[model samples]
Target: MKQVVENIESKPSTPILGHVSPSDVECMEEIAGENWNEDCAVYAFHSESLFIIPKQRNIKLSLATLKSEIYTISPIRVFDQNIRFAPLGLLRWSSRSRGLHHGTHRMHNKNQRKRLWPIWVLLEH
Candidate 1:
């Protein structure tokens, strides 16, 4: 996980509207111990202006992909300011099908909700 994080951080940032391959998603999923369907291509957005929300507070990193549908991979915690090492929390958004699905573990408590509110805010924005 550390190696993956280091690799991502060391590589040059992709353009704002660049592409992310299925292999990249697969690699991330493997590192994060999550299962992400890599059947379709993924797009990458390198937003220099967008930081984690909940200003001045600790927030997790999130990656949004819109290949087959809109889904987000948000970490439970920030891993040394790099997202690659953070444990994953999957959020699936499907309008035509079922609505939002929050599949995060241990997020049913008030304290967990408080910590995750910033991620929701950032996703909405």
Candidate 2:
């Protein structure tokens, strides 16, 4: 966790251009392709792939392919649970996979229960 924080702090922060509302599923589709879902958006944010343009107020996201380039419609890469930080399969488990409310799972005391909040990411349509 310290390494992750160090890595993030080392890079210059990118200015946010605009917001993506929950209603804008279309924009999410463009980035994640067909069959896009909440997991896709979550993955993008977790992987730090979304960025803003120099002169544009709109935000854009890019998915990496096997060649380590921005992905396009026709050429899908190995984007699955196998990738680090990718949402794990519903039934499968692995060292890199984190379950829903991962932090809460370790809390055995009832008083430690905390309300889980939803994550909201705004995407342009």
Tell me, by TM-score, which candidate is best. Answer: 1
User: Candidate 1's residue-wise lDDT over 15-122, tens digit each?
Assistant: 334332333344544443443222221212233122222212332234344323232333233323333222222343221112222323333565545333211212
59 in model 2: Cα distance from truth in Å?
Answer: 18
Worst 10 residues of 2 by lDDT: 68-77
Clashing pairs in 2: 20-122, 20-123, 21-122, 21-123
Return the top candidate by lDDT.
2
Name the weakest run of 10 consecutive residues (lDDT summed) in model 1: 116-125
Q: What C-alpha RMSD separates each model from the true structure?
A: 18.2, 17.9
Off by over 4 Å in 2: 1-20, 40-78, 84-125
TM-score of each predicted structure versus truth? 0.20, 0.18
Model 1, position 1: C-alpha lDDT score: 38
What do the candidate models score in CA lDDT, each in turn? 0.30, 0.31
Q: Over the stretch 1-125, how does candidate 2's per-residue lDDT look in tens digits?
A: 35443444544445434443333444643544444333432222243343322211333543333222221111111234342122212222221223222321121357766654332222233
